[model samples]
Target: MVTLEQSQPKAGERAYAQLLDEIQSGALPAGTVLAEMEQAARLHVSRTPLREALRRLVADGLVVQQSPRVTVVAPIDAHDIRALFEMRRALEESAARIAAERGDAARFAALADELTAARLDGETGRDAYYDLISRFDVELDRAVANDYIASALRTVRAHLVRVRRMARDRPERLTASVAEHLLIARALAARDGDLAAHATHVHLHNALASILANLENEGSA
Candidate 1:
């Protein structure tokens, strides 16, 4: 979705973003070789910028260097997903508690209303729901007012893209997720720290189970 012209000033950063998006979207699936020269030509960037981008992806754990000359997209599976959820549960539970204590009730109430009305019929609806989630994250971060927590969340979120995509398209799960989010938002609006934290924990627990089940189903298929 990124344009080359918009990436003129910082081509390396642009390349990183574009490549990361592709990997997360499963366009470049696990173990896809990222030949430097080939990618550079394809992305219309020079070798140096492409290498810089690869290095960033490596640091992000989205790509790995098999050798000096070979790079490939990293694999995703059950163990990795569980590890991610462990950390996500810790951070999100703590964040929800803090946000409940300090966040503006009106803001979270508004977000709850938005979630209540969210539609997940198709790609556009799904994208809109994600945007709403992003807005909720921004508000939660703002409410928490912790630089370190926010930084850690940004890192966790980057990897979550692939995990979420792998979670597959289940209408029931999508509907349940919106309901879970609504409960968390309403708890925050009520300034109920314990309820907010509990709601967040429950939501993450359900999400992890759903993703694991989906992965198992895929493997069986």
Candidate 2:
């Protein structure tokens, strides 16, 4: 196993974030091999630490390890997309409810700010939308104030990043998606648990519908 001597980060945590960032950005697209030795050298860490990082990603549903190869991001199909969004609908609805009840205005405000910034960037043909969505997810989870719920949603989000990109990458859809996010943020800001949960569920259902339509169109064409 590769290991790193870097003191600035918790070995496993640092490796996890770095690798996960690459995965979410599609830098390491699904089905790409992650050579432990290569990553260890590239990341300037030890094999021991790098292996630990891979394990963390495995737990997060970001990668799959098969013998004879270190690990690779798992390939997802159409079914995976539907299942992922279904999971998202359930977990996000619950998170939105908890956030409205337990989370503070400041956190909700920050989420709104992130969405606003991303919307502006996306309008101008910039690609900061993904980053902003990530920030929103984090803030929303923090608002929930429950680690278990946060972890579950985080795992689901990890798997959906690429598929969501498939749905959110279009210029028109990207803008509309951000608008939808703002609606949820507003509801949470007002501390309306019922409103927040309902908005979130409805939004996810719509997004899921879009994804399914897009994928079906792709398959048939």
Candidate 3:
């Protein structure tokens, strides 16, 4: 038997997060039909909250409801994915610059906390490393706190997560990722917009190059 304790984020939010995670992890994949009844049964939740959650995803451009009938995952392609992550780099770098100017100590401290955990992971992790990276990325969004930029960042992050498991697993790649993120953090601390923005561009460029290289290699082999 299990005890029912009321929780934070309410039921809709909880379901939304779980479903979002599933989609991001590639379990749900783009273009998969998501029947409401089936999802409610699978998630062990009522249809109302699940529907609400789906609506949220739809608005976020992660899902789409068809005319008079079915709901399916949104179609995403390599070009779209590239554009989204590139937008993230641009938006987040600008935010980091602003966050530093605003003197948001708590935000920086929060990032430090997450980085400390990533450092403890010591390189690769099937689970912990990603968890750490996710936290750091979200906080980077928070540190900015502009509504428009934040909205775009959130959307981009969610979309990118769909491919992140593939992007992040390379050991050599992961090592460099940590170092670049560290540079961004250091720049933010010093309130250097130019440095923060430049470092972020370099970081994203490197990540894009790595992902492209791996993908190209996969195609050849």
Q: Which candidate has the highest TM-score of all?
A: 1
**TM-score per model over all chains:** 0.93, 0.80, 0.80
After superposing candidate 1 on the true structure, give the runs of residues whose Cα lies further than 4 Å from its correct spot.
Answer: 1-9
> Per-residue lDDT tens digits of candidate 2, residues 46-119?
77878889988888778998775768888877788878878888888888888888778777777787777664
Residue 190 of candidate 3: its Cα lDDT? 73
Residue-level lDDT for 157 in candidate 3: 77
Error in Å for residue 161 of model 2: 2.6
lDDT of 1 by residue, 21-57 (tens): 9998999999999999999999988888899899989
Model 3 spans with C-alpha error above 4 angstroms: 1-9, 104-126, 138-142, 219-221
Candidate 2 regions off by >4 Å?
1-12, 68-70, 106-118, 121-132
Indicate the residue-level lDDT of 174 in model 2: 65
Compute the lDDT of residue 72 as modeled in candidate 2. 86
Q: What would you estimate as the lDDT of candidate 1?
A: 0.92
Q: lDDT: which candidate is best?
A: 1
